[model samples]
Target: NSTKPVIYPFNPNFITDYKGYKLGMSVEELDKLFAFRKENKYVNSAKEFQTVTGVSDSLLNAISPYFKFPDWVNQPKKQYTSYSNNKFENKKPIVKVDINLATQEDLIKVYGIGPALSERILKQKESLGGFVSMEQMQFIWGLSPEVVENLNKHFIVTAEPKISKVDINNASVKELAKFPYFNYSIAKEIVTHRSMNGEIKNIEDLTKIKGLPSEKIKIIALYLEF
Candidate 1:
């Protein structure tokens, strides 16, 4: 949104006239519309107005020649702030997100979430039945309270996630690495170790790996399915 308020001249001499055109709009309406146009135009140009609003080039050209804002237009006096500022500062309502319902890219778009955090959110969603409220986001390992609160401002829970049942016994090293806690090396170790031993007998086997600490194991376990 534009931070500058719309400027208009107090004197009417700055107004321009075009043949057969009517300034039927009141001054207040025109000022409001002008401000709206300045902030909302997807394409910021005279040509865009011509193309989208069906205003002809010739009409635009005629208006262009007459275009002159009064002296006051050149000296803006006040700042423009969106009304959302006050509303945003208040505690937002709890919103639920189905981790399975979100695309990885969508998850990343959350305020405090990056690729790693997104993966963790997805994994947790899969492990549990899916998030029931914004609070569930905090369950993901390493997700901070501040980050969760920050995200609450922008995200809402809408639908249930569609979790894929991962066969830990058959999943590839690359697939395992996609888990938030297990990066390339850790995922690779799990795959290699499993290949040698056949299949993991239980979730506890994960902790037996040298570098796989209990904390990391618990996080990985959150998303794993038999």
Candidate 2:
């Protein structure tokens, strides 16, 4: 007889179907429904409600219209906590990071640098000889002072860059190995080959050693100033 939703006065079972809505109920009944629903909040949608409550799709839809759902129903409202007065604001500036003296691992502790930017800082330092000042780091295309400032938070430059000499003609394996990145094997091969073949002509001569690859030589060449 009723194709559209059949409206009824109210049945306890029938009223439980609506997401707790009771259209034709007394105030006491409505209050009871509200209180019962408050204590026992249940899902109300066709897809999730049936899976959760084992209510059938048609029956769930039919029952949902009666009850007013819970207020804390949807996703939670995000509360923004104020951090304006936190200890981070009160942090003291103890030292200034000397960009020239810092390593890639050291440089990244500056606030905004991730692994990539830290490597970039190292590579840029290599290319430009070395960082003469904090300002020189900005020459890197994307390295900004604001980023440096955030990073500089815990940084302090304690040492100055020192000049060192390397003699292409006479650098021994042990002496060459003292350079930051030169390995024992590479340094040994360079000195042994040069000792047999006579003096090294230019920095490029070291690249021709049997085990010493050109890429490795190029990397070490940047650190050598003779």
> Evaluated with TM-score, which candidate comes out highest?
1
- Which regions of candidate 1 fall more than 4 Å away from where they truly are? 1-145, 152-160, 178-180, 195-198
- Give me the displacement of residue 48 in model 1, in angstroms: 50
- Please list the C-alpha lDDT of all candidates, in the order they appear: 0.55, 0.54
lDDT of 2 at 106: 76
After the best TM-score superposition of candidate 1, give how far the Cα of residue 137 lies from its true spot, in angstroms.
5.3
Query: Tens-digit lDDT track for model 1 on 1-226?
Result: 8574433322222222321134333344345435434332222344543454455566667444434443333332222123235765446654654444678887665554668878877777665556545656654565655567766665666753444545677888888777545678877888888888777766788776656656445545645675
In model 1, residue pairs whose N, Cα or C atoms come closer than 3 Å (at least 3 residues apart or on different chains), thus clashing, are 96-157, 101-161
* Cα lDDT tens digits for candidate 2, 1-83: 74565554332322552424433333454455454344333333334434434544566566555444433333222211243
**What's model 2's lDDT at 163?**
36
Cα lDDT over the full model 2: 0.54
